[model samples]
Target: MSSKPLLLLTPALAVIGLLFGGGLALALLQSVGYLAALGQTTLTLDAYRQLLSDPVFGRSLLLTLWIAVASTAVSTLLALMAALTLRRSFRARPVATFIFQSNLPIPHLVGAIGILLLFSQSGFLARLSHLLGLIQQPADFPALVFDPYGLGIMLEYIWKS
Candidate 1:
């Protein structure tokens, strides 16, 4: 067997291993307080212990879990409803299906970037809101992407799903 395909995939596989694996390793080391730069050579679980002990961290974890569950539930319900509607005989079924499935081809990364650009404080929606007198300025727009409630993240998950 020719090794051409393997050779072609070598670079991509190398990159994936180097970047993804290295990054994860570095993060793990740092999480365990093994950062050499800060003179933290000792491997310890103090960081994790502190995080688990912190009430804020607990609340944040709970909030994240809640958002994940809520978004998944909402997306499932919406998808089910859409599927049921599309299954029924209708004159515009083809068009509706086409519109619905159009986003399936888009990459999640691209969709996430689009969501950030459209939902951020200074994004198109905020600008439009300003022009429509909904808000005096972009700052007046509520935080979406980096909000405390992870609203933008949930929105992206729901949209992508």
Candidate 2:
């Protein structure tokens, strides 16, 4: 009921307005071509229009949408199956639960590096393959790290999620 409550809220409100509001405003301005540093002062929808009109852009957008949908569907299915199995009785239930959840606590960067170490062409798998005569050299192994289909990324997603 006193001025103290208003004073206490003022600084918090100002900080939120300065940080969150400023960030949103900056993003909106830059998205509409208002980046002074980049010399993009004109505000126009030409970029958006071009992206929509270009056939290559359209194909890329469709492919992105397809990958998103497929990844989501598969992730959901796999999660459901895991959930069902975890709730049922099994001898190695503890081990299964541990394996399913171990990735949860891991940082995303660590998980990504783990995936790279295991799956990259010059990774442990590739080196082992070479030693086992599966491939003459690590470089000769198929490029799985940055392949067009991004299988390594998908595997990382599945393992982490």
Candidate 3:
């Protein structure tokens, strides 16, 4: 074969160059203040320093780690349970498989919204409770949507995953 490595490598090289080159350009622009608006050309390390020092960011990072750990642990347990359950033949296997596969086609965001609508204080559960005389009104419903410990996000991950 003729020596034509550049011709053979052009497409792959172009993709690699575009990805890294664009990332480097953006980084340089951000670092040098080139991307800033009018009269904001001052170069500083304030952004980096603030990011390193912020308490909220620190807590958020910790929360993210905990969420990831919890999700992984829960998913592993669930997968084990599913494996054990599937090991035994049952009449519900087809229905369970269908539900599991159906979930694959529904987007996570849609599931999150559905969960919110079903579990929120003014949601379907609350209405059902009121109709069953368990509660006087939606306002009397207990909190579930805006829980302080990120239950909603955790539930969404569990359902989606």
Candidate 4:
């Protein structure tokens, strides 16, 4: 009986091993080629040296790191708040969970577009402002979408994630 179960599981295990092992082998080969010159086959750290000296690459790396750190911190805080709130009140628990889980079904790009539509100068909010006499035209509204500070991306993350 035990042998039968093992036999049945063998193919699945082999498939998983092949998938992961193939990927690892490809990555290893690529990394080796990347670390060494193809013609001379001499190992060198030239790529790493270049990466460290490139200002644009450095700036992008720093921006990525900042975004990762900020997102992690915010997610931790939000998770704690959600847990505490759930413990205190059960009334909106289902609704809150539904809203949070619903975000998973929406693509990131769609969420970004929604944020842009809602918060951009020519967006729904701006139109509402115009209707309310807060702004004479959309062009008079301040920029929110694609701002240098990445407020649009942050808003999208907050809404979706």
Best by TM-score, which number?
3
lDDT for position 113 in model 4: 86
lDDT, candidate 4, 10-86, per-residue tens: 99999999999999986766654543445645555666788889998988887777766776678778878877876
Query: Residue-wise lDDT of candidate 3 within 85-132, one digit each (tens)?
Result: 877889999888777667777898998898899888889999999999
- TM-scores for the candidates: 0.67, 0.70, 0.74, 0.69
Backbone clash pairs for candidate 4 read none
Local distance difference test values of all predictions, in order: 0.92, 0.84, 0.82, 0.78
Per-candidate clash tally: 0, 0, 0, 0
| Model 3: colliding residue pairs | none
Off by over 4 Å in 2: 1-26, 35-42, 50-63
lDDT of 1 by residue, 1-161 (tens): 99999999999999999999999999999989898998889999987898899999989889989898999999999999999999999999999999889889899888889988999998889999999999999879999988988899898889988
Q: Tell me which of candidates 1 and 3 scores higher on lDDT.
A: 1
Q: Candidate 3 has what TM-score?
A: 0.74
